[model samples]
Target: MEKQSIEQLQKICTQLRRDVLRMVHAVQSGHPGAPLGCAEFFVSLYFDILRHDPNFNMDGKDEDLFFLSNGHLSAGWYSVLARSGYFPVEELKTFRKINSRLQGHPATEEGLPGIRVASGSLGQGLSVALGAAQAKKLNGDDKLVYILLGDGELQEGQVWEAAMYAAHYGVDNLIATIDYNGQQIDGPTEKVMDLKNLKAKWEAFGWEVNEIKDGNNLEAVLEGLKKAKSLSGKGKPVMNLLYTEMGYGVDFMVGTHKWHGSPPSDEQLADALGQLEETLGDY
Candidate 1:
């Protein structure tokens, strides 16, 4: 695929945001907050940053690989995958439906074109991404590995273990990003379980850390990803602490955890579609 201009990427993000709202509202199931919040990141990665092949190969021999640790955000990932040609865009309508490849959480059993492994268990994607990164090294493939984790997921002990392992082994070819939206299924992360000073925490674990203060902004996300890639292959894994709203692009849903897994009502969906432009047309 040809490199898209920043303007083009922003338009894709708008379209993707629309896709997420419709996909979730269609089934009245699936998570929406994180997906809407991470739309810019997903669009930037797939359409601009990643050197990926949508043809879908398990080995991923010479192409960049991405893993979604916080798999509840599958709606946005699936939309991006389809829009990027991993599968038919029309298949997005079947999200979370029986026998659909687009499960609530990404799975490999159905052989989804863009999914390499089942996710959504949280605190486990980093471990999987680390293994893939190391395998690439063993196979003499220098392509980078990327993973996205929710900020709330950092509370899990397994995440810390993988963090330590990656840093200890110098998994520098990997770039891990935390969607620091600060809201979880229960409530605000601070009210639930505060993740104090995340930048300091990741740096303390021996990884290169950077922050994108406004992760919802397309330009900021693109720049942050570029910086993260530059830090790769330098003997330490890179971490991007991306700050975004849980329910961005939707006025009523923003800043709240209520929409984490809640699909919008018919009226609510109409309002959301009003907020997001129908760029590139709906899937």
Candidate 2:
């Protein structure tokens, strides 16, 4: 993939935000908060960081791979994947619709060009990523494996088990990131179940940890990703704690969990569109 400048990537982020809002609103269902918050990360990964082929294959040999553990962010991932040429951007209109490849959560049954496995059932993405990373190592494929997880999903015991396994087995080719937006479907993660001192926790689990304090900033996300990549192949898995607002970009949606799974009304959608500039044109 061709590398993009920070300015260009930022523009893509705006378009992705618009896409997420519209996709969710069109179905009047689907989670939007995490997708809105994660626009920068998704754009930076697909457009700049990932050494991937848009011509998708399940084997993923000799190419960097990404998995979304927090699958509710499907809208944003679908937009990035489409814009990056994994599938037609026009298909985005059918998101969450009946029999559409773009399901509410990413699934492989439709053979979605970009998705490798069924996801959205939280707490399982890391394990899947670890398996892929270990396979790459076994095949002598140096490309990295990346996965994104929601901070709220950390409440799941499986994440910790996977964390222990990654470090114990020295899965140095893997990089896992937590969307530390602090909000989930119910309320604040801290209120629902506090993930106190996440950096300390990951480090104690024997992994190299990095953080992006302003995850919404495109430049910051890019820098953070680069840093995480640098830490790879050092005999331990990498973890990036990315702090972002649950609902970013749109003013009304920002800073609240209410929009986590709620689609905006017609007027709200119009207002969100007004806030986001259509940089690459709507799908």
Candidate 3:
């Protein structure tokens, strides 16, 4: 890709991180850490990798689909979609309210653009994305399916089941990424439930796994994604264990699971915004 494209994507990622913080802090409830952590990955997919239209239709027959298995990070998804022109950015403030389309987790039944399936229960997104990939193949469409899962969420049994199914069935059109941020709600994933051999586990399941050390780095994410795309259609599903800092970009929230699901208070929000520029202006 061109330098200009990389620069643009980096800028967009920064702004998306800002939106994730601001929106979560405003509501005083939401998952900011994961969103901030996965900002670069989401930026790369929406602006560079995924072929999607801003005015997305519900059918999604022609567009590449993205499934957020760890749906608690809806703030990041909403911010990216809005910045990418999927919908009005003004609707972000209505997140988690009584009747807003932007809920804690995404639901297609709510008529939300850029989200095909409702996810929040965790560990189910890969299966959903795999099913979508199968549908794409049946229709003879070459569009790819992308799904993001949390490292802690990997402890779920269903994830491996889906992984085995995808590989055994030769679902080569899917690319699954793990936000290996090392932290989750209760504590570190290792402490909660040791994932001593994450890489080995994916490989054992027959996935072509790649690792990116710094998921917060936009350029690195783009390059890694390009590599993942190149490895697609190789008879095995592609998986990337993206190393991210949970609650990245904000010093206070970084390196801890405390801010995983809790929103920052007003003062904390002010502090966060103070640290981050209003690149696209606060909505």
Candidate 4:
């Protein structure tokens, strides 16, 4: 695959961030921090990196598949899926509303185009992603499986169990990224549950780990993802410790957990939107 120009992908990230903020503000509910912080990574995957079909194939034969382990950030994932043509971008308006396929978290019952699993319970996404990766290998498919996780979610024992299993089974086709923003709902993850020496921990679990210094920066995120891809099939599962600000792009929201599940009020929304310039045009 050819290297994608960073400038073009940056433009896409800007629009995705806008979609995230708008979706949350619309319902006055949902998570904005993770989505905002993770804007570049999502844009990089959908537009510049992943070999996926937005035409929406559930089985996803011979194509890369992604799962949102930290599903509360559905705002970001839904927007990217829609803008990428998995569904109509306008449907983003239904976010968090009753009877909308775009629920508070990614779900399967509604048969949402991009969601393969109903996530957001956290600590279980890696296991599901690994299952898909193993299935791909068994079916003689070389495609990869990707899952995004939250740092705070890692506190769950299931996450570690899945981590150990992936390494034990040599799930080399799987790439799991942690949203290491340091903040969860209550406060800083360290204060909540410190994951000291995270890289060493993953390495100890027998997985190859890659670190992205500035996950919010498009270039760093793209490079880290490409490196992880290159390291695939090398004999171990890959983990990306992607460090990002809790609330990125939005000035007031950045670096705090306050916005984790809090949507902005009318006045705050106006201020937030002003900071995030329209890139691909609002939905």
Q: Which pairs of residues have clashing backbones in candidate 4?
A: none
State the lDDT of candidate 4 residue by residue for 26-98, as single tens digits: 8888999999999999989998778988888999999999999999989999988998889999999999899
In order, the Cα lDDT scores of the candidates are 0.94, 0.94, 0.88, 0.91
Candidate ordering by TM-score (highest first): 2, 1, 4, 3
TM-score of each: 0.99, 0.99, 0.96, 0.98
Over 84-146, each residue of candidate 3 has an lDDT whose tens digit, in order, gives: 888899998898888999988999877888888899998999999999999999999988999
Worst 10 residues of 1 by lDDT: 274-283
Model 2 off-target regions past 4 Å? none
lDDT of 2 by residue, 1-283 (tens): 7788878888999999999999999999999999999999999899988999999989999999999999989999999999999999999999999979999899999989999989888899999999999999999999999999999999999999999999999999999999999998889988999999999999999999999999999999999999999999999999999999988999999989999999999999999999999999998
What number of clashing residue pairs does each candidate have, in the order they appear?
0, 0, 0, 0
Identify the runs in model 3 with alpha carbons over 4 angstroms from their true place: 1-4
Tens-place lDDT digits, model 1, residues 25-50? 99999899999999999999999899
Q: How big is the RMSD of model 1? A: 0.7
Off by over 4 Å in 1: none
lDDT of candidate model 4 versus the reference: 0.91
